[model samples]
Target: MMWKTVLITIFAAGVLADDFSQITAVVTSQCTKNNAEDKVPEVEAALRTFGNCLKGLVDLNVLKTEIEEAKPNGALDEVFKKYCDKSAQLKGCISSVLQGVRPCVGNEYANHINDAQNSTNQLIDFVCYKDGDRIALFIAEGGPECFQQKTENLKTCFLNLKQSFPTVESANNLSLVEKCAKVDEMTSCIVKSLEECSTPTPANMAESLIKFMRKDSPCHTALPVSIV
Candidate 1:
């Protein structure tokens, strides 16, 4: 039984390592591309720091889950407070890496910051300290983990559309639209409306759509969406 436990632990460790490696690869690519062709040391520093914080994220996520399960009095307050604290820490670390890095690296850090912003709210809400926290977290983190899966599907659908797209009329017939049928348009409209509200009414929905329609380029600027 002891040996079996050890093997199980090892297997779990391996899976975690693999997951981290993949995330690292994505970040590294983003950084290296954005930054100049030369600066590698800075990228390494960013990865190490990101990895460290990722460790803390894992712990904090677990801790929050535990608190939620225990349902201690005023536990929600504590959970949210810790979330705010950790989120600030994550932003600072990510900012440090972004500084002096190239554009590719900048993009990487930007995405991480965006993700961090989202995660911050989530931990807080899991404790139910904030109103609308439950609904926000529900769409963002709950519901069969559909957001992640759908995002992946959207990317894939876009790629295929780019590759062997059918006629323009049927372009919207992609796979993502189907599986997310129960949720797609509503979600997209919510984000788009929020984007519009961020700027003046003489806004550019076309530009908004283009920001996504086009490849993620250095020239394009899009409004930030909160994830946490």
Candidate 2:
């Protein structure tokens, strides 16, 4: 009778071990770079946490002979089923995040990046109010056409602070104006991305500010960006 209980317990534990091992491999197989190298140690750490949490019910050694004699029940089966179910879910979320580096996924991220760039440029126009060859703070707002021409080779950011800094800062507001013009543009881009995900609209260019994060959008799978 004791041998019968031991056999059942060993069988159950073996099945559980096999399922858990497969889940570990499924997670480790992802997150690689060009040479098939794992991205980082951090990825392993995260996978361990996920695997451990899922298999926390796995230790059956505590069951004595009488407890095991009852034979396999639905409860034991449910534990293995939960692992397969949750591993699938974790796989999907990881795939989505990794898509960011993929060509298709990169393109998707780029769309947001491009939208972010356009939105940033608009804020530059609103703030710099560049007109003709002359730039002044008090001038009227320019349309998209203001960005049509480059102040330098930089079409998106109106002024390059890297080159603009000079005798201007110690000299007067002109330097300050030049410095702020570029910095403010970066701020606009960040804010616009948040908006696009939340409040996107076709009627409004400012709607870039209301961006909707469409992971399943055709943009993610069809264009230059996609997950592997």
TM-score of each: 0.39, 0.19
Local lDDT at 47 for model 2:
41
How much does candidate 2 score in TM-score? Answer: 0.19
Writing each residue's lDDT as its tens digit, candidate 2 over 37-127 gives 3443443344444344435633446432322342244232233333333443434433333232232212323345334333334433333
Per-residue lDDT of 1-228 in model 1, one digit per residue for the tens?
112222222322333353556544544564455555455555545556655655765575586575565354534444544555555565564444434233343442444444333343343333333533332333323322343434554465345433443453343464533423312333343344333332322123223333333223222223233211
Candidate 2 regions with alpha-carbon error over 4 angstroms: 1-38, 60-67, 72-228
Whole-model Cα lDDT of every candidate shown, in order: 0.40, 0.33
Candidate 1 CA-lDDT value: 0.40
Best by lDDT: 1
